[model samples]
Target chain A: MTRLRAAAALALAAPLALAACGGEDDGTVTLRYAFWDDPQRPALEAMIDAFGEDHPDIRIELEQTPWDEYWPGLDSQFAGEAAPDVFWNHVSRFPAYASSGVLLPLTDRIEESGLGTAAYPEDLYASWQFEGDQYGLPKDWDSIAMVYRIDALEAAGIDPSEIDDLEWNPVDGGTYVEFLQKLTVDANGENALSPDFDPENVVQYGAAMASSTGQTDWWNYAVQNGCELQNEPWGDYAVDAPECVEAIQFTADLYNRWGVAVPAEVTNQPNGSLASEQVTAGAAATALDGSWTLGVYRDGLEPGTWAVADNPSGPAGSGTVINGLSNAVYAGTEHPDEAWEFVEFLGSEQAQAIAADLGSVWPGVSSLNGRFADYWAGQGVDVSGFQTAAEGTTTEYPLSLDDAAFSTAALDEFNQVWLGDKDAQAAADAVVAIANE
Target chain B: MARLGTRYPSSTVNALNPVVDPARRTRRDRSTATAYALLAPSLVGFAVFLVLPIAAVFALSLFEWNLLTDPEFVGLRNYRDLAEDERALKSIGNTFYYVLLNIPIQTVLALLLALVLNSKIKGRNVFRVIYVLPWMAMPVALGVIWRWVFDPVNGGLNRFLDLFGVDGASWLNDTAWAMPVVASVNVWQYTGYTMLFFLAGLQAIPAELYEAADVDGASRTHRFFAITLPLLRPAMLFVLVTSVIGSFQVFDTIHVMTAGGPAGSTATLNYQIYLESFTQRSAGYGSMLAVVLFAVIAAITLLQVLLFRKRTVYDFS
Candidate 1:
């Protein structure tokens, strides 16, 4: 009986033996900063190292999760009360995390630190808020544009300068479609404009759009063609508008009817991005992608091969979808003071300038915009198109409760339309039904 | 060194035995204590990792939680909601379809491979290793490679088809073909692993039984049915049970390949549970689905055990 008692006691004490190994009292506070940008990691690390210089008593750890895994990984960590002291927050995801009280409200901290929002765009600053509590400090802003092959356009007997003024309408598709057809080549070496152009044996498409859902693709077209996705921030989704149907139908026709865009079957093969991949491989002449994709393009293609231009103007005029990433602190952080200090430093001129020089994204601080443009120009890539588009009338990617559910449903329904299994109108109705339900 | 007298009656032998040492009871108790001490670590680990989580899943099923907010006690509400959820219902049906597509074909292929390897052939050991190698590779890596192979436009599969004058078809992207493609990939990965068990079972069967069947004027096919198959019941049951459980829990490959897309044709129950919990933040509803899944797997396993209880021939000697 005594031996049995001793065995039971030892068994019960096993986990305690393991637990005792954790959390020794140390004078130095270690803070974990989680973010998802691989290209910007070096700049971020430099910023962190610079912050560590002034405060040697504090150490910062970088937790890099890929974009798709970041949200779920952070959610699980938050559930276990072990989320990083600081992490990147997206505007679309801010509502869910901020409302759940996993994020620390930064309004009071911003005031105490004398970090005024006057230097940031009002919408960008407001994007990280939930119910009037600032939950994020603006990091960077991104907008979409048309990235095209310069040599392909020049070889097609078209002036490269004409790209900036391309226009389109729902019925005629305007000069933009004409330019597309000129660039699109069939296997017989005939351009799409030729009557002999065969869709089945196309060697190169004129343009490509990502098959998946994002503000950078058809959603941008939907808004640019005069569809309102939301009545308010985090409000009802309204994709059933006539303008939305027209925009989606036109985009789908680029693949199914005109055969000028890469098929979804090719574009959505796991990790493949049709727009970027096709353009890089010379399978497509152009892509309508975001400013965030600029680094990838520059890294993959030669500097003189591609150039950026403003997206084609629809009947309603040019429209861009603008979104930003924000730095947010975990509400359950053990080192709130240190985390806030790092987040504050991240918004300062020094960190923003470092981020600007990286040329990966447009720094959220409006004053650093010229510096970013200069950095891109130094790299021999003109980014004036993205800036011009951002300055125009633009739509915000809506922030909603459980946005993933709505977005996933939208992508599933839209994929049917993209595959020619359903019409745009039916898909739009399905998206609206799912969103409303 | 003492021997008990044979003259003593059997009933009184134990009581009258002087050979029993006085410290025997204490020695036995000490050995039992040592055995329990050795078992303690694993028992604690099992309770912590497996038992507690299952209990927590069951408890969470009766509540409404979004993980970020405080859990509210809402008895049976999640289960009730699950009953009406069209997506959840579809995923349940899809999971069954995946199991039906995977198990029989995988088992038959594995058995055939096992049988071929059991025969006298050149480099049979090398072939055995080659067959099991796919199962050893990471599931994530396999899914990635297969996604490229099944790519509709630029994939190797399409290129191979072109050589035969066959028009390439949309594979993973097509709703009709997506589930089958995913099932085939899984079957390809697991067939070798299941083959090892069948090989062991086949080798364990006595050659004398076949000789006896031959003497009874039975042919090879008749001997296989009347002798080989009856003895192979144990391996079949094991393979079927494991394959069903594995099919029910499949998530990573589908997540990487289809992401439960092309109009939700490939969204199995596990994928639905993941979407509900992690993606949608409806952990409570996800727990309900997980509980339902547990109930289903448990019932199926129980049925198989009951059906095989008397049919299995364990006394091969």
Candidate 2:
């Protein structure tokens, strides 16, 4: 009788346990928004709070990942049909996502939200569009710029005005190289560029050529020199082209032939913090860093030491590579409407103004340029040159989701060139081989 | 039957029983057999986990699969690529160098520590525990601590060097020092574990022999060579074999310390396999490297066993 009673009890408890595990039907909608920028979290949170106040019926979840891990994580999530409703996208990575049908078309959303196409620059908007469908709404934009030590330039007896009229063409920019050489002084009484320059006793370098981030500055030169990274419609690798090789060689020569820049071995040292720690330690006079580095340099160096300038031109023309981040809805999102609504809110004038005010990024909308410039100027940074450089961009590469594999292969091949194991031409050819394969 | 028993011998009658006829057993008889029944669970486990997975890995190695897509068969291509791969070759060289660094240092240190503890020392157990503490710590945690200690800037090693006005070198970043630093950490962690084995081997050596050597006026070093070493040959062989295998398979420290960087200076074969499989999404190439590593390990282990078997003197009597 006791066993019978226990069996009946067990049978009853099974359904109760199952019921506890069952999914609930809450009337409130949940939206998942993913992004990679930790520095911009406060602004994003403020924007989301405003959106939440407007729509109390919706609940939003923020998924934050570091930029390196972001795309791969998103790719795996999309593959598993578990992607967030909205996520940050980049111009370089958008094409691969759009091609894979993972991004939701935002054409109708953009039209319906009353955010006219003209509000954002056409090229910026077109960068996020592919195959007649807009997959991403521009969130922010940026371009390459020269970051230099203002005091160092003045102390070296070189006028900063010399860089103002610096005409850059694809073929030759010897003047800019000379300027860098003149400004680079061995303040520690150790000559770094003279005939008696001690490689071991290098107290100061003239400039640092950025190499860790895929030789991005070199790519800008390549584009200016009439070398396309890929053929139109993004079909072929053009890194092996003579023009691209020249561009790559020119940047590599800054370290090798010119002796104006530090050795790649020293600058590329793993965990060495070469640029931030060593460069800001007053060891390097200049660095060809991204505009985003304004924040890093400001935090790293003493006040009134640095200023910004346009990148020198090559023989082809003066060029800058424009890149930006965008917000896109995941195609497999369960709450597509809610995701689109959030994306529209992100693109709104109010949100962009808030973003501009925070000085986090250059807001994508053209009308917000004044707000962004004023914000930076108020922070004691000269950002007027950045606006001009962004406007003068001649080429840009779409950051592909496959950049993890493609970039690793390319970087490994290029490391040989930096290490003096292979020439620039060979490195370029090797990169093409690896990328296409 | 009683009459037959009366007529036959007891031994003959016993032999005629059905239990004595082993060849005539049926399926049910075999199922009821004790030995086979006892081993059934272990046999099933071995078949399911070990044998089956090894077979599957062998099959997988012949295909080009990235886990995201269907695997396509491409026989010997992965192997061919492995031959030409400069990175894989460099890694192989690095792995051998690690083995060379680890085995001798670890074995000698372990033996030396065991000998010191075997003496008439107070608080011997306390010393043993202190020495073995590194082995007890989690490897990942140990790696993190070591990374800080070996850090080029603001590190313990650098600060220690600064006391003597010696400039601190980039221990983890400099290619020349990176592998040696990693090897030194491995030696530090494993010496105590190996020392335990040597201690056990030393304890088993009969005290009478050492007394005899002492009576002969043998020096401590001479006694160690004549009495202790010969008896500890088996322990030395065990240490060498295990240390060599462990060194070849080193991944964690290298992964944490370098991630095979500073121009691929410290990349080992195992690290390369990880990079190829996970980082590059080239599973086919990774599996090929894995197969090669397995073969190399197998060959080395077998060779060591054969070489050490002849050298080891196990008799204490």
Candidate 3:
């Protein structure tokens, strides 16, 4: 009887023991981190490597979803309760995720960890807060600037320095249009100013105005023209103001009326390339792009052939659309402590330095921001213009509770505005109604 | 001859001994049992994969669920919402427009392609494989390549047009051109697939009929109308039914290429469903859209079946 009981117990315990082991017999926790930007992968991998050395009990897995499909895919994953342990979150998406109770409340965790919030930019850091709870830590910052090709400028016989102070008004596009017209070369080797210049068969475009996301394109124009994106934070969209409408019309005229920029057919919503991609491909001479895309240019363009300059001064003076991404922990994450640990590491100055040294983007740690410019200087490209934009006038992308709806609605309406199928004021009103509904 | 409602059409039930009762009945019982056993796996699969999800979608349509929150029973509210939804209505119209543009042209082209390839032409086998290549490719990848080909300024189509001093229109971004461009892509990808069915259907028609036509001194057009056209019904029915259904559910190509834009000209119902479910996080409304899509496709399929049943002969054997 005793012998039989022993055998039975052994049979039952065998599978139990195997199940208990569960692939991590050493007790190492594997945290899945998801992000959308591919260019920032190396810096992120380096952060993972650095984190792993100090905490050998933790391992990290990185998931890279492209920007085009990222939010939609992430929404599905969140709905299915299968979101990554830690993922990059945008300000536009934070309110809905936080309000829906899908984001892990990090206030207690951040407080318990004794991590300093002073290292982060105040607006960006606070943007992730909801209902008196902190949900994310600022990871990086971005400011818009003009990414221009030096050869294109030289060929047009226009000095590159001349673009820094270029001013514009909604009525005539001011000196900015004239400056771009110089760089707009025709197939017959004549610029836009020449009588022989033909807009139909242009060999090279002067500028690329990406009408998809005006954050780095026309939003600056709107903000400089003293237009607010919304009535208030977490409020209805207010881009239908006359100043905002004029700014949008001016941006369109660059492609349609002035014909200096690349046409909307290839540079507007739904099927357009990024402004940075257009400049990198030499389809256009210059584009107003964000600091996050600096690495794309460094890797894409010939070294020392491209340089950055401050955005042109608008009617209300120069302004960059300042935005930043934060590291957010999914509330559904199985390993909450480890996910918190990873986010805390990402927010630290040490990790920020590692990211900064690569010159991919401005570091979240304010003290380390200048190091990003230094790294670019070492690469033979002066990127201080980005710093100037950041230091000078700036505006945040509109804050709202459910920007996913707004973004979809705006893309549909503004696409027509960019295509010249609908007027700016009408498109703005349509988008606002649909989004607010 | 085997008729429609008969059992044991080939006499396989009692091949060795015909004048038996008890033995034959026992064998028949065992055969019926065996047939049930053979069909069990696939029947189970059909119920689980198709029937269950469809039932779930219908149930989901009655709720107000966004996936992140708990579902609330709204009971026909989503349907009510659909009535007022402008985009939803537009998407339905857009899908019909796309099907009208795509199906007829693709079907006629596929038939012609199969007929030509079936003839005694040089390199016909190579042509068969070449035509099917687009069908075999990934639709998303093909959409990307097509986008490059249709780019307004730097596209091959425009550059080609420029050689003759005729500027090509902005094919994918123009409201007038967007639907046609997207529909053309569907036609391009699936025409060869449709052709394969027609080719098989053409081959199945014995050459004896054509020889008989030749003996009667029938013209090519007369033979096609009198014989070839009538005989290819089964394949035509299969291609037309499946192609129309596939065209109605086109999301990947539109998602990758136009994203239902150039001012909502290409926004089909399926794309709108994805937008509502995934982008807007309104899976309840999305499910209602899905149910509507299922009903539309099912009604059309039933219509095709009823139309074909009277004319189709299944027992060519």
Candidate 4:
């Protein structure tokens, strides 16, 4: 009878022992923070340090993953109920994560922190809010801009000042095309603008547009010309709009008809950094890329060779796409308070200024003010155009979770048009069908 | 006889005899049970790891689960979508191209190397080890080293080409050259293993037969065709079928090297399945691709078996 009683006692004690080992302390808290940008690690670490100094009671663990592996890793972690307390989320991917309830709604935190919606640029802030709830705080912002090889333009005997204020109506952008043609010079010392030009032995290119995944502002051009990407938000495919077709055709024609840009066949070469590398190597005159390239090109290229400018205006106006990254607290966090603290610190002006100074990103807060612009100026890059492009003049596109898949399908269809195998109308139709399905 | 004190004690023994036999039966039963107890660990492991997981995957394929929410049953919708998927179709085509490029080239190269090594050469063992070094090297390490060698701008291949005044083309970036480069890398790695099979087949081709062919005024070519070729059919069949299956499932090198890029030029079905499942979070679509890939590999192996059975004879005299 005593042995039976002892066995029951052991059985009861075993579960209590396991429970004690697994449960967290109310006094101490641990938080996990995840992000994809490896280059931003130092700045993030510094911010975490500041957060730690402010909140000594809470400990935060940092998790760094590469961009390609970041999403999948988060998904698995979330499923296992081991998700990080705070994570870096992209606007394009936020909807999917939010819909799945992996992200904690931070509407209350935003209100309590005294950071109003008006504090951020409206579009940039709105991108983090969806479905009547705010899921993230704006972390960093970027915009598309034109980067040019200054020497290449001057050597072609074209004054860069004339094209600086060049405007376009999409219908009457002949001047933009003419400027591009004039800037394009070949091996025989004959410019593309000249009547006696050889297409076979073309040496230098006028412009380069990266149609691949990284920097695609061609959609902005389409939007400026009255092309709707989706039927507002996540409704239906609208890239097949007539104006969108015209815009894509004009972009493709820059390569095929005018011979100013490198053909997609050569430019699409895998692992070939045709845009930045070629521009830096003096093979291409201008490149359409993010303002982030100011740092990359300035550090990579010879001094006094490159400069940044605003994207050329389209039919509607000079519009640019302002892109930003956001930070979210995961729903299944063990230490929700600590995670919120870390996230709030990340949004703090001091952290943003430090991040801006380190050249990590354009700080999301406006109060951080011109620190990033000053950093760019220090690097010998005139970034006033990028700043102008990032202000109220810019537009921010809606990034749904399906954007990656849709973009992949769209680009594949566009490749056929770029190769001249199909026209713009057919390609757009194919892309729409594929994207809808 | 030693304790013969009990003619009356026999009556006492009869009372306890039946109880003693029952106790003996219980002990025998317990020993028999111990044998099954010893086998329980392996049986449990096999059932839990292999059979149960495979069953789970099959059940999971019918649902629309992204490993987040409870799976919602979608019936055959995932499979139906896969059938019309252009990405899956392209991947299947790319996988076939890889197999087509790898099987014939790897088999021939292996057989040729095997023949050369079979010759009466000095330090034959050393040569064999040298040839097999690539097979033994870690695949990831090999991939990184090969990427450096095949780097378009400053690669060893281009430097060598430059020595001959040939303009360096982007080996990995160009769609036309990517698969061939990947296939060549696979061939370089697997040729030695395949060569071992060929070498064994070569050694088994009796010395007496070759001598007899020579006495019959047959040249080396004639002798090889008449003797070595027919006898090595078994090895060739084994190499071809296995290499075809292996090439169809090629993932690691391509993943490390091209990443199914240059606009999805090298995206094989295996790589696509990986991407769809992990990158796109479409496990249902990924499973469908996996099932199709399995069907393709099964069909090819079955075809090879049917074709090779007619040509190969296993009689050893």
| A123-198 per-residue lDDT for model 2 (tens digits) | 7888887889999888988877777888778777778888755544324446877676665555455343355555
Measured with C-alpha atoms, the lDDT of residue A340 in candidate 1 is 93
- Tens-digit lDDT track for model 4 on A1-437? 33432232233233333333564567767777898766678888888888778787787778998665687788656544566789998876788888878888889877887865565677677787778998888898888778898888888877877756655454534667777877777778888868888775567788876645434436757755667677777777777888888888887787788877765655642333457766777667887777655556775687777788777777766767678888899886766767887788887787788898877778888766588878777777777776777663554555565655676667666765665657889888887886777
Q: Which candidate is the best by DockQ?
A: 3
lDDT of 1 by residue, B232-277 (tens): 8878888889888999999989998888877889999999999888
| DockQ comparison, 1 vs 4, better candidate | 1
Ranking by lDDT: 3, 1, 4, 2
Residues B1-317, model 4: lDDT tens digits: 22112246676778666555788889978987997799888776666555554555565567565644445668888888876777788888999888889888888888999999999899898989998999999887888788778876457988799889887766776678889999899999999999999999999888999888878999989988889998898788888888888889999899778778655788999999877776676765676677778888899899988787765644544
Q: Model 2 over residues B1-317: C-alpha lDDT tens digits? A: 12211256678888677474455566547776877889898886666545654554566567675433345678988888877788789999988988888888888998899999988799999999999999999776887788779765456988799889898876765678878888899899999999999999999999998899888999989988878898787777778788888889998887766667655777889888877765665666777888888899999999998777666534445
Candidate 1 wrong stretches, greater than 4 Å:
A1-26, A269-274, B1-25, B313-317
TM-score (C-alpha, index-matched) for candidate 2: 0.76
Model 1: colliding residue pairs: none
Summarize candidate 3's per-residue lDDT along B122-237 as a digit string, tens digits: 99999999999999999999999999999987888998999999979999899999899989998999999999999999999999989989999999999999899988987888
Model 1's TM-score against the true structure: 0.92
Residue A32 CA displacement from its true place in model 1, Å:
2.0
Deviation of model 3 at B131, angstroms = 1.3
The alpha-carbon RMSD over the true interface for every model, in angstroms, is 9.9, 15.0, 13.9, 12.7
Regions of model 2 farther than 4 Å from truth: A1-38, A48-87, A91-96, A100-118, A129-134, A166-173, A187-200, A231-233, A269-274, A328-344, A398-406, B1-63, B66-86, B117-219, B222-245, B291-313
Q: Can you write out model 3's per-residue Cα lDDT over A137-185, one digit (the tens) per residue?
A: 9899898888899999999998877888898887777888888998899
